[model samples]
Structures are given as structure tokens and as C-alpha cells.
Target: MALSLCCAWISILLLLLPSLSHGGKLLVVPMVGSHWLSMQEVVEKLSERGHEVVVLVPEVSWQMETTQAYKVVTHPVSQTLEELDNSFQEYVAVHLTQKPFPLNALAMYNTSVHVFNSFFGQCKDLFRSQETLRFLNQSGFDALLTDPAFMCGTILAHHLSLPFVFFMRGFPCNLHFAAPQCSSPLSYVPRLFSFNSDHMTFFQRVENTLISLLELDYCNGFYGEALKLSSEVLQRDVSLMDLVNSAAIWILRFDFVFEYVRPVMPNMVFVGGINCAKKKPLPKEIAPSLLNCGHAISLHNVCELEGWDFSFLFQISLMLFDRLMESPLNLINKAKNNILNKNIRIKLYLRHSITSGPRRVGAGLRFKRQILAGSTI
Candidate 1:
């Protein structure tokens, strides 16, 4: 069956990954909430394939409405040298560069308020110090694939010369747009000013100009502060914008169901659906949503999907599970059915309903190991 073929490929990919690990540490940083759920899907498969994966994430992520199964390292977010560099334009003005300094300095201070500000200011000094360089060099990570939200991570990646992969949690931000068009406007950015006079309607043009001001101010702040040491130490002007542009990767974490997906680039992939498999199985109320998704959630398709192909399958199935779990009445009846399992044996196959075939095999393997190790027959 197709399920059997998929299983074989998944096993092949997983087996291949350990060889790639090369006896080195595998560190993964997953984003919060549904993002974490996506990471969990991959982690479970990887772990099952015999690779050890340590999840590093913000401490507060677990407390949110995640899938409630994955265990991740909960660390406080840190401000990295790259971020300090973002606002470094101020430092750059006072110290280095001789290109229209005063006007740029004024712009830098104005853009500081509209950013993804956080409590990381406390560790700013440490991260920019030599201590950070030493820490990165000694972390012993062979490979790192993390979210772009953390500047410290990317900077650490750069300092250590370790290969790093970045996973973008939302739509990729273009050169001019900080926030998505439908989402909350980045408050610090004034407006985008990239458009010419005939480009758009008045309101859109105004918004664009405002976004542009924010970006310019952001650039001014960045070139001034973050790279100030460059002219003095390394003899150059490094900007935050430049550093961000250089991040190794940006993996989008959304379903193709969303509107207006951008064209795929070499560094950016449409892995929009990478976390939907039942490597386990649907919860009590998820069957209907699977029904709603029409034909995507098939045991045959799922069992047979292997390697990178499963990423798309997981995305669709995960979305359906999310949609189904939203119904209260369905949840209550699922509970009732479980309680009435004795009377339902003649019809619905309740015991096998929630079971995933591959996981059952995993479970069987574990049991066989235990029995083989037993002292008694």
C-alpha cells in the first residue's frame, strides 16, 4: 500500500540524518504555540529515528496553548550583539563615518520605539562582550537551526562560524515592510515612503511613507549604534539591516491556505505545512475536521509518506486537527463515547481509532526490547 511505501522512505531519511549528525549535538529552537507544535512533529519523528534532539525555546512558550506534548528547553530570550548593532547608528555617528552625520543621528533616535522590544536589555552588555564570543565557540553545537526572532542566536552563529538555519514563523518581511499588511502595524515605523507619486491611493501612499520613515529611522539607528565599533575596531560600517539580510535561512511556517503567498526563492521555501502527521493519532474530536479537509487525512497516505514529503502531509492534517478540536459538542461526545466503550465494541473501532500505525510499531519494538532484556522467560 502507499502507507507502506511512505513508512520506508521516512525510515530512510531518519537513518540518513544520524549519519549527518556525525556524532555531534543536534540543537533545535522552535517558536511558540502552533509553531512549537510544528517543531514537535519533526522532533518526534527524528527522535523515533534514533537521533537525540534538544529543543531550545523561550521559557514562556510552554505555558501557552501548544499541543501540550513536546518538551523544550525554556531559556530566557537574550539580546545579541546584532540587535545592539541595530540601534548602533547612534554610536556610529559619534565615533565613525563622515557622511552627513547629524541628520542621520536625529533619525536614529526617532525609530527606537517601534520594534520587537523585550526584557533582553539586561543582558545586552554581556552579549556584546568577549564572554559571548567564548560562549559561542564553546557551545559544542555542530549545527543550529533556529528562529530569526532571536538576534543573539544569529550573532552567536556568526561568531562561532557554525552553520545555522533560520526558520521564519510568518510571511517573509520584504525590504520595506516590517509587519504584514493585515497584521498590526509596527508602531515604531512611521510609514513606507518607497512608492512614487502615481503608485497607490492616498491612504496607501501615506502608510507607505510612514513605513518608509520607520525603516529609514531604523536604518539610521542601526548603522549608528550596532556597527560603531567597526570603524574603530574592524574599520568598517556594518548595519543591522545588512546583518538581517545575511541570516542563513527563513523557513515559513504557514499553510498554503493563507492568502498571497510570495514567490519562493532559493533561500526561502514554501514549507508552509511541515507539522501535520499523526505519527500518533487524532484526538477524540479530530475525525470530523479530517472529514472536512476532504481527502488529505488518509491513513494510507500518511503511512506511506516519508522523508521531506511528509512535511506537506503533516501541515494539512495538523490544520484539520486544530479545526476539529475547536468544537465543544464534539469534544463532549468523544468523552461520552470513551466512557461507553463497552457498549460500542460492536460498531466503532474505538481502540484503534486513536492509534497511529507507525507509532504502534514503535511501541512494539520497545516492548520487544524490554522482554528480551528480562531475566525471566
Candidate 2:
């Protein structure tokens, strides 16, 4: 009896040992705005799983808030919140108004440069602070989690000599695939901003190859300041690709549904639809109206609707519908007028059939009546 009790106690201790030793301290360096939203979910989950998470943010930031899930450590920065907001607004304005191909691309590139410059200014301040550096050095973090949309986290992870993982949709110029040594054939794998599909024609393939050649130069110019800053911080010559290649793992925020068929590296893990894990209920004011509407159209890009010339879309809808409404033109006019006046920017959903149920038209309206009527919002 005594031997059996001792053996049982030993077995219990062995089982508990693994759980006790599993948790580790993690340092998270996240990007601002929408990027942070998805990354925040990851931080919270890590905390819940018994790991200690420390989120590093700038003194003046857009939406990097303090929370119970992780400890927040803010560093001093040169730029203010107002400057960041203005730069983003300017970018949006240029993106919305510009239409010509190369001209629009040029305008966007210029605005993005200004925005990244502002972010780099803050990064410079982070490295300048001896106090912040000292704290990080003493923290004894096991690993780092960061969004590689910007270089601050990548540089910092290297400075700290910590094993880091990247959590992002992807990097521009197909650097994500290139850094991982993943196979990306130009024949089918389209270059960024090339606007070519996976299945390309003979001429399109030539265009893709040309763009692929330009990508290296484009990335170098785009991240020129970051590369310089990285060299200064690390006291070594480091290219952006070198920094990207150093990541121990890549937590991609997409799955096969969103991405085309391609070769992925062993280190890459896909966790698509992570953003939709937590869904908020519809607003009380709009829920009932949305549920009652039968046929709704969800417009994702409001900028595309700015011109209010939907004659082509109306024609398509007419073909989809079996029978036209009493006044098709009037319905279109009312939708345009309502959208202009109300400035509705929410996602709208459309039912499968026009004859099946009630028809209402407006912007910023969402419907789940057909597909998701039984599910909780």
C-alpha cells in the first residue's frame, strides 16, 4: 500500500511538471491601427495560456491602448498623434481621388514614404532611450512577437538577440516569400501591384517578369531609411531581406481561401479569419431594419462609390434579377441620394433573389436575413 501511494504521487508530480514549465515571458512589438487589432487578439490569447506578455508601444500612438491581458510599456517618440492622423488622412485622400494608373501609384508611394518617415522618427527615439534599453535587456523574455509591417520591431528583436516571430498578412514586393526561400514562380505567382492573376497570358507573363525585376529596387528605395537605421542600431550591415530572414517563424494571417495556390515554407503557419473570431452585435438602431430588408448589396470600398455612376452595376443587377422593379431608375436615384446625404460607410449585404423579399436601398446598411438569420450577430 505504501509503495502504491508513493508511485501515484510521483506520477502526479510528473504530470504537473510539464504544465508548470510550459509558460514563458514574451515581448510583443505591434504596429499601430488595424494591424494592432488582430495582433492584440494574439497577445490576449498568449496571456490566457499562462505566458507573461509585454506590449511595447510609442508614447504617442494611434490605438495602442493599455489592457489587462498584457503589460504595456511605452517609449518616448518625437512625433505626435496629430501628425500621425494627418499623414494617414492625406494618404486616404490621395488614394480616393487619384485614378490614373502610374500617376496614382506615384501619389500613393509619396504619401506612404511620408507616413513611414514619421514612424521611423519614433523608432529612432526608442533606440535613443537608455532606460528603455536597460529594461528590455533585464526582462529575460523567451521570445518576441511582432508585426513586420514596420522595421522597429525587427531591429529591436535583433538588438535584444531574441528569437522572434512575424505576424502579418505579408510584406510588400513579395519579400515574405523571398525571405522564407519559398518558391514563387513569376509565371503564375503575380508580383505585387502588377495586377496580374495566377493564370497569365504570354504578354502578362512578360509584364510580371519585368515587375519582378523592379521589385528589388523598389523595396530598397522604400525601406532605405529603415535599412540605414537598422545598420546604425545593430552596428552591422543588414538588409531588409536579412532582417526578414532572421525570423524563427511566420504567423501568416491568411489561408488558402484568401491566397492562391503556392508553395509555402515549413515555418509559415496560416491562421486565416482570425479577425472575425470576435464579432460584435449590430447596432440596435440598424439591426431591425437590416433584418427586414430582403435584397441588399454589400459595398466594401466606399471610394469606388464616390462617383455615383452605378449604371453598369445596375445593369448587372437587372440581369441577375428575374423581374425588374416598378421604377429601377428611381431606386438607383434614391440610393445615390441617401448614400450622399447620410455618408453611410458600413458594409451592406444583399439577399440572393430580388423577388424573394422586401427591397430597401441605402448605404451603411448590413443584412443577414438570408444566410445568417439563425446565428447570433
What's the lDDT for residue 119 in model 2? 77
Tens digit per residue, CA lDDT, model 2, 260-357? 67778889999876854654544465456545655443433545566553443333333333222321322332333223212322332332332334
Give the Cα lDDT of each candidate: 0.43, 0.74
> Of the candidates shown, which would achieve the greatest lDDT relative to the real structure?
2
Worst 10 residues of 1 by lDDT: 359-368
Scored by lDDT, model 2 comes in at: 0.74
Total clashing pairs in model 1: 32
Model 1 RMSD vs true structure: 19.5
